[model samples]
Target: MKPTLRAALTSPFVVFTVFMLGKIYLSWFVIFESAFSWLPLLTGLPTVWAAFAPIELFARKRKLMLYMIVNVVFTSVYFAAIMYYKYFGVIVTYHALQQVGQVTEVKGSVFSLLHPYFLFIYTDIVLFGLLLTFRRTFRSWAVRGMTLNRAAAGLIFPLALMVSIFCMWTNRDSINEIKQAQHMGILNYELYAIFAKRSEPLLDESEITAEAIMKAKGLAANPSPNYWRAAEGKNIVVLQLEAFQNFLLGLSVDGQEITPNMNSLMKQNFYFPHIFQMVSQGNTSDAEYMLNTSFYVPPYGAAAQDYGDRALPSLPKEFRGIGYEALTFHTNDVVFWNREELYKALGFTRYYDKSFYGDADTVAFGASDEVLYDKTVTEMARLQGEGKRFYANIISMSGHHPFNLPDRKKKIELPDRFDDTLVGDYLTAQQYADYAIGQFIDKLKETGLWDQTVLFIYGDHMGLPIYSLSSKEHALMKDMLGRDYSYPDMLNIPLIIAGGGVTSPQVFPQIGGHVDFMPTIANLAGISLADHLHFGQDLLNTQHNLLPERYYLPSGSLINDTTIYVPGRGYADGVTYALPTGDGAMPSEDEYKRALELLHMSDSYVNQLPKHD
Candidate 1:
């Protein structure tokens, strides 16, 4: 073979291609499992080459070694994305890249998803290293006269760009990101997401005007509370449960209840079993942002990371306006997801995070819920003694992902069928978290604050990821749910509001999301948010509600009165499921339009908020 041809065959470009192909190949197997398509896999090539061509063309001989290093770095990104998507059901973005530093706290969950097969992407690097070490054996690459000229390498950029752009334009209509990733490949899908986000117009002042607020308020159903503000002047405590889904509320295996405390609480409170979580890329922090600000998460990123700098109009600020002190407590450090800045933007009077909670009783990520509630209640008692009404946002961390708690912390015993399974570990951890919550309630009653306080509890997001299960485990969960696990099942979380002053213990079957919490809670507190530019309506007053699920689900997936609509490639190709049941159906075209309109308005509203310090 000619020296130039042989040299080209052994170039770092070849190694980079091999690494990326392995990445796409391994990711495909991990996601769809045994699903094969050559064209889809081939499409990952042009974009990878396009990204590398410029870097290579501009660098000198000294940077030749750096090429292999860069190849490793880029391949690692896909490795991380594949591992994340296994449990998250969503792809990580460039925005998520900024938050990678925060993964140390949740390394437990990260390591759980990793497998030995994940190392396949690195095999090419090993091969390249071996070739370098044994240069004499590979004469084609080690030949002194085989050098790449700038003119010859210049051809790669145009060839790659043309192919990459063609892929993007052809797949522009692919709205379902999962399908898009499958069809266009990961490299192309990422480029597609970048343009999709950049093309979105910012929300303007007109979108948040008084007239807009009135129009949004008109969409709500008439108020039907037995007595409005029944618990006015009382303390408000909101518990954000980590990964606690609605199915676990009354779930029993072998006659052993999974969440006995919550099951009992649901009977005496307003239980909205149909409420779905609306968190975006931020996950738990997104839940907090939604509940406080009543805004949609940014189209492509976590609201906390994307909008933390803006002065947000929030539940805490509204409570402060009503002569109440507001504070939020979480077990994690304040710097995670830039929460210290986010809390300030949300108008929190004070935030008590990891430093305040200590390491008394630790969990997967931080301090245990047992310690969180204990410390919070102690502070609440101090405020109660001072005759002050407070609004407290408490975030629980015990039921986090990987759901593996020590044996001493576990309370529920699994049957023989569930031994050492993800489902079993989840139940044990959630049950213990519930037990801690039950303990907190008892402490409230013991301190005589139970009757004088109005409390709300909700899961931050879904517990079990649909994609994380083995066939046997999936079958077990399917048998328990009586159907295939789906978007509705994945996003459905328990929302319970209970206290002594909640005179009527009723079940509200209306569909809602995190967006609705601030409005609903405000209405129950005798504070009307009708004048504010909020995305959610009061569930208590609204006869029905429909909210879009952004981030975790497809962009167009939404929860309504009795169904969840998930777009396939786009609104044209989507699936719908009956609420609280996994039964499938064909959603009408009008439903599609409504879902689109809701998403557009939500995006517009958040974009319109004034940028702040």
Candidate 2:
């Protein structure tokens, strides 16, 4: 080897720079599928040097140790971004730190997302550790020492820092997080997110009214609404199935039904096939919050963590106001997602959690779905005996992620190819969940509570993420869905309203989201939302809707009646994916502005609400 080239390669600064650049490029490739662009290089250089500058300037000794530490930290950030993108299909920021406590609970699902190649990000760190173990060998090849001159260091440090800051400032307005990360570089973007403040002005509560929200959403009021107060004075039962998606409604594999009970329920009641999920970082808890309050989550964190401390207007409060008792049932601990505070904020009269269900037949977090429904029914019957009109929420957790149902609980058989695959496991789990639901229904009928109550069933969020699927699983989903599984399919979940009010069977094809659940249920329960502040319209009476997405998708993504539009940098460079109906609709700037304004209004209104003592 040439002496000059060998010396440069042996230098710690050059060696560390090479490793960081390689990892950065790898992250770009994994996320965007194209890393050849010069943007990452241009933005990455200054950002990386900015971190190196201070140590290079002031540190006179132990330079190698500091560099290695910094390198490991940067590598960790890049690795986290890659893993998070694979799991959530969005860039990771410091805001995710709030969810670190939840990682251990869902470790199975977290590990399932790991690919063998992703571990390469840590190869250099391992080798460095080993080399450090044998100091003589490491020093033999390592450079003796090196440092930038005082004057040179002073100039380079500030210049590099300024360049990085400039990159972040220019692209700060980009609504699509991925595009912003690409332009400013992942390192610069992460740093900017930690230090930056929102520049937009918050709208006053007075300016945020139902008329303004309706106008922004482009939805008109229905004078003679169908099914209004149809289930008046009846009991309300809501079933929130975890990780359940619409594709499982009538799916069959090898002539075996995936969710036969739900299919039958759909045939005998009101089924909404076009409802999409609107959960944020809190996942299931976010679904509950949106369903009860009919409001969007915070811009940066989960609603439970950010807004649960306030006294929010919700469906439960609406019921409680009319002398009806309100309660919720979940097998998990109430503290898992700050749900204790959330339940209080939602105004539930009572909540039965792990303490009420016990640890028997445990599934993901606590008791299995069978136990949840079994115990919940007993309590429901008790409430009925008390002559109480009640609102009861039951959340099912057996079909959660990493869908590994216990063999004793498994209710379906899979083909050889389907065995041991993520998709197969998911189907088997859903089948078991369906069986549990069947048992719950039979119990309700025997107790005669079925005819006296209004049962509402819906999915909490998506189970399978498109980016996390393998090629084989992708092919399997294509065969099941009749095409490649897209964003629309991932976001779509079923909403079935049965018993009391829904006497006739029918399917509603209008587009809606969890945000619309509050008003829809209020209307059917013969409750008035006139004095209450809610952002959702009654889905049974609406044909036009605009659903703005967050957390899972980009910032500017919106769903209309015909298609889901995802913005790149803005409306012009954005793309539209067809819904189940396959409509070729175009996106407009006016619609994009309206979607954003609605979100801002929601945030403003919720923020201005008075906190509970």
Candidate 3:
């Protein structure tokens, strides 16, 4: 018998209710197995009712098809949320919508995280469709008269909206975005995203008075006027590496060197062993912006997309002041991630992207590192002959995630333990990356520009995750390090200063971030930034270092000399762990307070500023 109007109202709603709760449980199981927060499951009921409530007006076939469509959309979102959480350790936000350009560069890493098990989310709809399509008896249910169930329909919309309001009120003071997201559930979070518009400003715009600037300067290190800028008039060459972490620096397998070129350069240049990445949503672009401006990245979307129109005060602008032409070179199209506008905001004299180089060698979805360097050096040489002082920013890409390279260029012979493993593939690609960068350095020397140019070589961000490793691999890594490898180790990237007048090698043992890049470079170039609204300190002169973490870690988390403190939900429930050891302990209150202050001030400064036309 065909089901009645009452059956239509109640039947699919029951199935949808199951799908809704099941998906939430699945999302929980994926991220933290055997652990869950039940509130989102409970809170999501109203949304399910709201969804199915509108279905009564349509015929049964249309209703079933529409319900199947809803399942598809939600399944996709929850699956994306699962993948996002696995990689970033945070709930995916609406801001990620703008990051599609990055998918091509990071697909290897992304695809690695995804497994066939994710298909379970859609199984309910698939089974429902199959049952209806194959069974002639079930098809009778599809022709249920197009009738409105006023009693059921009248209640769902109002109840959903009202419950959503209650969830919002309950989560109002939950300022921690992650905590708030968990409490409200997926459907409610999307609603919150719409209403919240943006986060509340951490500080009043009027509070950035002279005293605030004085307080900011007080929190940072006092720089020696010309301690580092002795190479004031030299040309600048900066290498911004992608997914290049410091773990592979001295790593060797089967007695072969992983990075013979960078290893040799660190012996004679200024190498920072403790610099951490501080990029926000912009990632690589954020790194470039921070390296030049000494300013915080926008807390929301990428600065390239959101603040690309602003007249950003940057290193390029500083170079332009002294008759130097500032240029940047990337292997991808200049328009990727809206970088063309970013270059404009940062004031680059010219940008050399894919259009400038021929397609002889391509890797990592773009031109190879070999092409990037050869063309960049050739152009720099021409500019030098033309008597143009230049600041050339070169961004490298070969060592990017999913780190697999062409088999011909795979030089490493991995032990059976690492064969076909993520880390093993990463090492092979990095070896190639090292070889490419080495060629560039050699060419610079061959052209006699090595001594005349000051090169700042540094990593853009962390590439690998400890969670991606198997137990054996993790144990092997621990054995290699002779200790527990944690956040500090994973986030550490190489920062080298070569050919800038120092006769011997030196290593800065202090911790720093990209925020300090311009200040340090400015000091070396004899350009003072004491009067500017800068957040970073010159690491060359500081004895104490404090850096607040963002993006990868929870808000209010910070790193100091001996500890890396990551909060559970907020500052009150935070845990501090010793560096490289992963031993839990209490953090220093004074330094931690200072770090939070810096984060707040930076957020305040950026958010309160007006966007330029």
Candidate 4:
């Protein structure tokens, strides 16, 4: 019955702004987990106005419809950002539109990320839809407008536009994308990204040589590189385990081993305990690209989507040049994540996907890891019988995310506390993956393929992202790891290189990334990368590395020998976290500069590569 309050609340301007502001608050809480602050509102208002102010400026009628459309659009953006951040720990941009198909394929993973509160973002739309059924109520609520005068519209339009542009321009150089979005507002940041030019010019093709890459990485030529040509002439086998992490190595659940086979392999081979996953939007495909090409993924999108057309210089290509048959095997369809084109670009002699694996024993995307290894081993045996020198890239799938393995595949027994949780599911799935790897290794041995093969096994990316963990799951992880699981632990993945004369049973503590795989393998296989322009150094030879990370972590993030430096705005305000070694030594500005330079060099070189026919 309060007429003045009801009238003010019914004003169209106040109604729309309130809805937007509430959505902004939810988005901020989900993304930043910060207490109430005026920054988002201050930065977000102008951008929000730019979207809706036009309706007031131009259209007199159908204003409600336009506002509704804009509201829906903004709400979707905020909701998407929230969902994406929960798993990825990064603000999603429009570049994510390219991943719409990929997202649909992983609906289980997407749905698992959804919270009931997240769905509340659409409550207003639902109410509005219900009101639409009653024309009188809809008109009374939506059309009861406090219309802005032409003079006010003229003033607000330019001022809001200028403010949005200013926000974008001022915050453009903030290398940390999350901080940039925070400072400039998420909506404005998305707009800025769409139109933003590359901050630095591309280097000339001649300037992007291997030597230049080495220099930028602070690594010089190694005259007598360690483990050089140790596996010269051996069959190359690369097994990319899906969503596996380093913490799983030797990890136990109440006296039972989690990855026994991998632990055994690590004990008898060259194991890298400090390699971090550097995948971007492409996830597994990004890891594949980085491992084979020694290149960073694209800045904003998946490598397979953005650079799959290029005939990339890769480990497979290098091996094929030396009279080896290079092939890749994945359980999923080749079209998923555009890996068909990606495999071709990497210069594989042949690739076997879902068609080869068949739909039988399917888990997440395709055939289970057991089936993948079983069939792949049979094929490898055939190749061996034919006396073919081969380079095989086998991608395991059973351990993919949403980690809910079928009961038949669940080999690990979870305690009551670990029941029905992501961490528990992840462990069981990875345990199954380990069992599959064990089977594959045995088959390799039985067929005499193990002794002759230069086997490289590594986790594709992280599985239990810290952002995806519930509080109980977080506590569980802390219990498992003996400490709070941090970014370094999240990004860390195991890299095991067995056979191929790498029987040293040594664990390399030197920091490395997926990008280091190619050079490291090339060295062991007697293949020279002197002519190859790669961003990563060989982990076997290099004692120090500055591994620049993307996607899951923020921009301007890098892993050095002693710490992971994550920038707040830029390096000045960045925080340093200890690696597993317990040294949180701050990275230098030079290292940070070189890390960025290395990324740029990779981008420039890859961008100039000849497109595949």
Candidate 5:
């Protein structure tokens, strides 16, 4: 072979090999401990190969620089948008810097563009872009390198084919196993490609149907004594409080209270101290999906966006069928997640958003909690006076990110010991929300609808990180939680169910998720849920045990419930707390296997949900 030709052929391959090794290294370092296997490497080969192809064409410094610049710009922007939406609940802006504490040079705005996370994301994008740009390079190398002899070509082709086939067959089970374990939507396309190549049959509809039916039967067999049976034709009001944390109950100023109304209301309500939300996606829309549909969000994308065009089962549809007029109110932009479309898909009769209210109603994102609550009550009364039972969803926005309010905002006094700028502001916002709820309840009572209404309230998710309370103010939270105070506290929120004239208050100890709310409410309202094989069980019924310690990430599943953190491959049980069998220990082989099965089942069921037509 000519030297130039040889170098041309080998250069791209070498770069490609280096890239793959990097991926393997990173995967091992980060994901491997979580039970991830080699499947990600194998499935990512096409993109990896494509990324290196560019090295042959744009091998020159000028071209490479241009390519790198373009790649970096796009990747940085894309990831920044994603991070902003995911963590901060808004678009990226100059003002975001003010929200984070300890902004050193490394954490500076310009530095954030080149942050490690952004580098990882950009690497993948650039790698894939190269692979796509260099298809001709591969074809040229393959043709020039192969022998002209027909017999030689025949022998080499079949040998290559046979080896490829053998490897695929050997790895088929492992690949399927990994795909089944992944819960993140971002990786689904690659996983689907692998399954398609192997010609593995997708999950069967009948299996899902059977699982749903069995779950329904089990639920019917064990009903909660506290379950509120449908009052033939009563109004139902659901208040989904955005970022309402249970810790707010402990918040105070100057030995006074922040959430006095919420604290008082809790005394009259059935509160679930350990109720967990099985949110499919980590956004507001995901919470809505779990609450309304009682179905897991497909791990790969936004359920609301994906199912916006498809028909799906919803709580409002059931309520409407039973003589209730259904409405949804969001004190924010209706178009935020295509929520207007989603509400229609969920069978809501009327949808109200910021556009429906006055300009003075505006809060941080949209309407103030006071304005939203008052408007909702007014609307409910109008509907009630029309001789119609109502099914209304009131989604609050005041307690959302930036946690800011007008300076004149009602201040809830807090103890001197609990004084901190951000935490104090956050507590004040919670107090404001609690005040709104109290006012709404009072309006219900005044209208004589308190006894005839069923009220359900829960947090959308955890409070956004309070930069002021970082390691300095919340040192104890970090010490006791074993995690940064930011992460775990963000996941803990309050869930309270009251009204329908229940005289006694009780606390539910079982861990339940938002998805469980739908079926539980449906059961109370005498509506049969369409899909019973959901990850969420009826929280009202405490017969089932708590959910295993599992965190479903966009990439894969983390089963941290057992003392060890078992990902997909092995156990890290000894790293944290030991398992019961104890050796200061690792998860038993059986425990790892069971965790794998549960993750697989969750993935399979979610992937196989009937796509809206």
Candidate 6:
């Protein structure tokens, strides 16, 4: 070949080869981090480069620009949506963007934009910069001779290579940070996709039968069955208090309790004083799924919304089978979590939301707790008077985020601490809920229906941060609990079972989640649940421990006894000196392998459920 022709062919080839190598380097970096090992360095680099070589030939300036722009924009928008939903329980759209400026730093920008979801955007930006450099070099070469001299070229490629290697070295550390942040935010979509595709057998009849036998044998040994059996024919009412917490349970102003009604009710109810809710995907709706369906939320994606049509056995369904008029009442938009569809599928005969009752006097996201409770009580009485058994789930709205209540000065007095502040306002709302609940119960008593009614109340999720609160408010919480503030505690709302006939108040000690309510209540009411394999066990059943088993997408599967966190490959389990485990360490390899097998089995079971359906 001629010298000039040879150089022309070889120059682009050299740049293309370098670019290909860089791409290979990036892929290997991801693999290395994913594997949690340097093992990928030995095999992935050269193999990936060879596999990607053809794409290098087509790398042109225009093509590179388009690719960079698309990836950057796509990734940025994707991450922004994730973050927006994480903080506000809503997505960012063109209409939402218009209102973005109205929100404060903590509420909108700082809280939403600074989250780990933004890391994906940052990764996209880095990729864009790399693409731009390649594009600029190619453009310069196409117009004239390559701009970099032999010395510059030698320095540039080697420098790029070195930096690329350095990035690869640190990628694992970076991913660890990303994983922590991602877990705190919304569900991890990529992780869900991985496990969903791995086909495994669903829970077989033998397994369930064995588990049932174990549960039954254990239950027979307990004396609480009589209390549970006596709970029949009582009207069951569950109040899913949005963003409530035990902190609120103790919160008092000037020695006067904020939740006076709750305090009084606690004295008369079967309260699980230290009950911990085992959550799946972090969201109000997913909590509802866990609480109602007793099925595990697939750690990534919108499982509640995605599985809306899936046949899942629920408490309402069990109640309906026993001649009860099952109903669900929500203050917010029923369509928000696809609750309208999901509720009906779960066998709620009558569904009520903002549309059902006009939104003119609604508070926060929907109707005030007072109004919702008043209406629900009225409906419950109406149904009961008609000689029908009733199961009504009333979801409160006043305690939701941006915790604002409409101006209504009831007979109850607000404490001096509940001034015009966010936390104060939130407390005031809780007070309102307590008052409404108290009134509802009083009305039931007037009708002589109090003895025949069962009341269940718990929080939906944790409260969001109130920017207006002093650093001291945040500090008090952190000091009392040595961790970053979370919405989960707020989600850990008090669950009380109260009625005139509820015998003695006893605190159940096992760890139970929202999902447990269905099975627990159903079993107590002597209702059989068919077509659903629930992950939640009855808390009232003292035989089997309702262990908290969490499937954290992309990495870990945590059962109360063991936590298997695998950022990448072959797997390593260590023992820790934590409860469940004697030394707060991870399990041994043999233990880990066993745990992994169980997780795989669980995943297989979840995946196979739909096929059976």
Off by over 4 Å in 6: 1-71, 74-226, 253-256, 280-282, 404-429, 464-473, 479-491, 528-533, 543-546, 549-613
Over 316-408, each residue of candidate 6 has an lDDT whose tens digit, in order, gives 777777778888888777877667667765767788888866676666666676677777777777777899888887777666665555567
User: In lDDT terms, which candidate is top?
Assistant: 2
All-Cα superposition RMSD per candidate: 3.4, 1.7, 3.7, 1.7, 9.6, 9.0
lDDT agreement of model 4 with the native: 0.87
Whole-model lDDT, candidate 2? 0.88
Q: Which stretches of candidate 4 lie over 4 Å from their true place?
A: 1-5, 145-154
Query: Candidate 2: where are CA atoms >4 Å away?
Result: 136-159
Taking all chains together, the TM-score of candidate 4 against the true structure is 0.97
Better of 2 and 3 by lDDT: 2
Residue 516 C-alpha lDDT in model 5 = 71
lDDT of 5 by residue, 165-196 (tens): 44444443432223332221112233333454
Ranking, lDDT, top scorer first: 2, 4, 1, 3, 5, 6
State each model's CA lDDT, in order: 0.79, 0.88, 0.75, 0.87, 0.56, 0.53
Lowest summed lDDT over 10 consecutive residues: which window, candidate 5? 181-190
Per-candidate TM vs. native? 0.90, 0.97, 0.89, 0.97, 0.66, 0.66
Task: Please report the TM-score between candidate 6 and the true structure.
Answer: 0.66
**Cand. 3 TM to true fold:** 0.89
| Pairs clashing within candidate 1 | 203-607, 203-608, 204-608
Candidate 1 lDDT over residue span 1-613, tens digit each: 9877877766666656666777777777886566677865567777777777776677655454666666777677678778878878877667777667778877888888777778777787788778878875443442343444566568877987888788777877777777777777777777677776544554565554545543533363354654368668888889999999989988888788888999999998889988888887788999999999888887766778888888788999999999899999998889998898899889888999999998777887788888898888998989999998899999999999898897779887787888867887888899999999999999999887898899989998998888887787888888777898776787889999989568777998777889889988887788876667777877776766657676687777776676788888877778777865445566666666666555666667666567766
Better of 1 and 5 by TM-score: 1
Q: Ten residues in a row with the worst lDDT in model 4?
A: 139-148
